[model samples]
Target: MIVSDPATPHRREGFESAPDPRLYNDDLAPTEPIRRTWTTYNYLALWFSMSMEVTTYMLASSLIAGGMNWKQAVLTILLGNVIVLIPMLLNAHAGAKYGIPFPVFVRASFGPMGANIPAILRAIVACGWFGIQSWIGGQAIAQMVAVLAPSTTGSPVVTWVCFLGFWALNMFVIWRGVESIRFLQSFSAPFMLIMSGLLLFFMLHKAGGFGPMLSAPSHFATHSAFWHFFFPSLTAMVGYWATLSLNIPDFTRYAKNQESQLVGQAFGLPVAMVLYSFIGIACTSASTIVFGRPIWSPVELLGEFHQPFLAFLGLVALLIATLNVNIGANVVGPSNDISNLAPSVISFRTGGLITGFLGLAMMPWKLMASFGSYVFGWLVGYSGLLGPVAGIMVADYFLVRGTQLDTYSLYRRGGMYEYSKGINPAAMISLVVGVAAALVGRVMPLVSFLYDYAWFVGFFLSGALYFVMMLGHRVRRSAVVS
Candidate 1:
């Protein structure tokens, strides 16, 4: 009944000398293979969309809340970006070199069957965050709707309706898959920039100048309390954004070449983040003067506006912006991860839908309301694992493996990645030990002062543990063979 086309090119044959072609697409073969797929400008737009969102603004303000002056706060943000740049650049190079997602790339270091461990962990984190961000975006929508319809706003039923409506809308777009995502991003990125510009113009008009906005906060009575608050907040900002740095390969795999990947990171990440941080400062500062209260949430500030049309438009823009960030930075990486676990059963679109559905069902508002601060701190501590995993991967690939990955080993169980019965004990031990060491301070209040440096601690511990374990394993195996 079916005849294969004799002239059809073999799927793997068309792949350009890359370690893995699956990296290029979201594991879905393009109707026609994309040769000249992405440009530098596309990446610039991506980073801009990533940074110019309510979550980013909220985090930046948190840094200010930590008692750092504007200058120190900005520096702390910059340092965090720089700290993440190491793994970001390495991971992007691997993606551009291999044309695969991060989960697939890890097969080189973790081994084929071993790769699933990191993949599952990453997917879990992404799914949790997807639910959280969507719920947050839903709350913004509900609040904006209430502003428009004051009569209906007070009812709990109306709030749930708005949340479900926004949730369904995001699912519709996500289900349409990558092309729809690209198109949604096209309008979203430009619209957010325009909105930010409008907010900045309004702030300048309302607050007099930028200098007064930055210097106005002199409420801290003690220098020690100020620095104490400032450092952790700064570290938190770094840790939160550090999530993106680990997953940068998710997007860079589509890059036309290595040069394009480098250019994208160089131009895209820092510049876009800095601009967003500045706008957040200006907008929040203006809100303080105009509303006479420090309105941390952008939607809250927008809600205070008398004009219903403007308020509605702002929420719409925010919704688009939030979705853009969540899908690119949060959803895509994990979706591919889930598919990696079961390619035949779980298509990329299906995986994305699973994440999106779970996100909607979870209802992040209750979590945020009850445990926002502790949750934020925990996420930061958790992300420290990324730094070490990343370091070990880089060391393994470039230093140990000499930039050559056995691609086929990733598909075959008990091959390159599988160590003992489909698990890599060395890798597992490193992750567990590093995680425990990083969080020991947090769990034990007597030594909680060390909790803030969890990122660095986890990173070093994971790398050291991995290297030593692997070295010992190699030696034992060699002695037995001899």
Candidate 2:
């Protein structure tokens, strides 16, 4: 039962009276309603900041390079983001309703101890993303440094110095905590949008307008070829965001209400993604006309400008954009996830620090070396792993529990969530089955399409399996008053 205080009417009474020491910590505790101040604008700003990064540019341009026309490329990105938004909003509902982060929220379906499985999996992926974004930010810094001091150009030491310096900046922000991220995103979103528009204006002027910029014909020779490539590219696009589809609760837990999260995400995600992706596609297509070849990397494209001041400004914008995405998208979930493990021992700051160090160890430079490796191998590969987790979370929350979570029980041992010693076999088994089905194509050449459609296959198969497996199992209704 929720005990309302007259003085703090908005604050939902949590398990604060006495929560299990083994399972509870300040960081993992349910958010007080009074503290849930994030509004629709905050969520909109969050997506806008995240969407205007170098990776999103690469994602769109890579599609064009892979043989699609500019129109085809933008359409794919639009459709993919729209598809992923469904799951994104679904998972966010639990967070908004329960005022709990993803780790605590997952305890309902995965069990308290078993929740660590998905938490760790999601954390590892966030580490890789952290590394990638840091590398991009570092490259921007190095480019600026090289412009200022011509002699430092192509120097490995200078590159490493800039990389480490940029990495440190990200860590400093993470150390400041989540509110810093909110401030950063809210402050940077409009500025990044303006910078993106300026970049687009420059590209359009260079290419002599959209006629030449988007004139490139589709490279697919036949209808069959286009269809064949479309499915995987669509899947790759969906896979690009599959990570966030599961961990969205980490952010939405702070939302003032479900309407704020849902409407904000609806207005923010797909629109920003499509708009920025269009900028990327147009700029890249324009590059072929201006530079005599396609230059996909924005950093490299900026370097072509002979005016050091112009390049410096562009690089600065890129730096801010990278930092916004890295801190907001990459750091939050992993910090919360890592803190969930031994909550008494590790705090969010410590978990973020661990994430930073592990990101360096991932050697993200190698991952970003080629477009094929980055898009097909890395994006699609991780999507296969995360899709099932999303499937189970959505199925369990919306279908099984009817979006009602027992908040008090979530942070206690020997509660409704303590399935078979704190591990839900049904969820585990379904996750394994989902992953196997989605990834089977990797081993069996004939069914390789399964790997292409990794996210869809894993999501549907696992959600169905979990629903069936959960039948006849007793689920306790939420005790926390709404």
lDDT of each: 0.67, 0.89
Write one digit per residue (lDDT tens) for candidate 2, span 342-426: 8999999999999999999999999999888898888888888889999999999888877766676787788778989999999
Among residues 3 or more apart in sequence or in different chains, the pairs in candidate 1 whose N, CA or C atoms overlap within 3 Å are 23-99, 23-100, 111-417, 112-417, 131-359
lDDT score for residue 146 of model 1: 81
RMSD to truth, every model:
5.5, 2.9
Please name the candidate that would achieve the greatest TM-score relative to the true structure.
Answer: 2
**lDDT leader:** 2
Report the Cα lDDT for residue 240, model 1: 68
Runs in model 2 with CA error above 4 Å?
1-17, 474-482
Q: Write the per-residue lDDT of candidate 1 for residues 1-482, one digit (tens) a residue.
A: 11112112132334433223332333722222264366786777777888888777776665555455666667777777666666678777766665556777777667656677777766766776777677668777887868877776657787677667776776776677766656655667778889888877877777787765766564578988776665555456656655566566667767777788788777777777778887776677667777787666787787788878877887878888988887777778778777777776787888888877766565566545522362245456656556556656766666555555544444445544567766677777777787777677878988665567676777777877787777755555446446
How many clashes show up in model 1? 5
